[model samples]
Target: MRLSRRDALAALVAGGVGSLAGCGAPTARSSPSSREAAGDAAETPVGDHELATLVAVAEAVYPSEVEGVGEFVRTYTGSRVEGAGSYARGVAEAVGTLDDYAAEFHDIEYASLPASTRRETLEYMSVDDVAPDPDGTEAQRVRHYLVNELLYALYTSPTGASLAGLENPPGHPGGTRSYREGPDA
Candidate 1:
């Protein structure tokens, strides 16, 4: 099913992930393969609960677990190189560090809120009032950050790529450039 942001957040809260960092949600982003799972286990600094939260949010955004897409993003994020660290941090901060926002808007510890409340709060935040544009102001900055982070994280996902018809690496033996040859060519 298509999970709205509210739905995702609700799930997160329900899973007892009221941690300061927001790393306690259920997820559907399974390992692409045994090898990948092993690799992730070895590489990820975040614990399983946090990983699960990441996966849940990602799947909510993309919903393509069977295809190994969500796993790929999570694995890539764990590496913390190639700007992933900054990207992930910004995303967390945008979401009000998960805990801070939950405390302020939801009026409960991030972990204490009920699932329903989490979803409602998420819906409350996904609008212009909660996510305003950048204007050298803190609130606007947070809003802009959340909007950009969510968009970037989701749009760069495999499901997002599939939706846009962007061929994956393995699909093209040589590379994308080879397939991009125009009809004229």
Candidate 2:
């Protein structure tokens, strides 16, 4: 039967709504269930939430008394484009994945947990197996995507170099040529 333009529009909208109502929950989930599970999730923009998550993870991994993740993350993640997207995106995704894993295992978010839980969780990642290259371990994954990157940034900075007893590390030149004393000093 023929209908007026307004009637046709109304009928179309009703049909669309009816079809949507019958649909159930999605059959397939794209996101990884844990850090161990690899699944496709749409890339989200990196922001403070992600950065805070990374800072927590980094501190847990390194357990530094004098250093924090802020300067290291800001410097390395600033200009470089690496991992997942930019350096910032890589840090965000790694931390997000870790949080996903924590929620799946403990029914709680990573940052919300106590410091002990975070440490145990990261250690647990080390032995989680994909076989072949040992790098597949969750620890390694965390290290590669989070810790090592942060460490590299930290150890190369003037402060970190001094801590490591190096005079003018590779990336950080310090002030003048003589700014750094020998290891004996």
- Model 2 misplacement above 4 A: 1-44, 67-87, 127-139, 175-180, 183-185
* Cα-based TM-score, every candidate: 0.40, 0.58
Q: Model 1, 114: alpha-carbon shift in Å?
A: 7.0
Worst 10 residues of 2 by lDDT: 20-29
Cα shift from native, residue 144, model 2 (Å): 1.5
Report the Cα lDDT for residue 112, model 2: 69
Question: For model 2, how does the per-residue alpha-carbon lDDT over 65-161 read when each residue is reduced to its tens digit?
Answer: 5454554454343323222333333445467667777899898877766877877787666623323221244444556556665555555555555
Q: Best-fitting candidate, measured by lDDT?
A: 2
Instruction: Provide the global lDDT of candidate 2 against the true structure.
Output: 0.49
By summed lDDT, the worst window of 10 consecutive residues in model 1 runs over: 22-31
Pairs that collide in candidate 1 are 18-110, 18-111
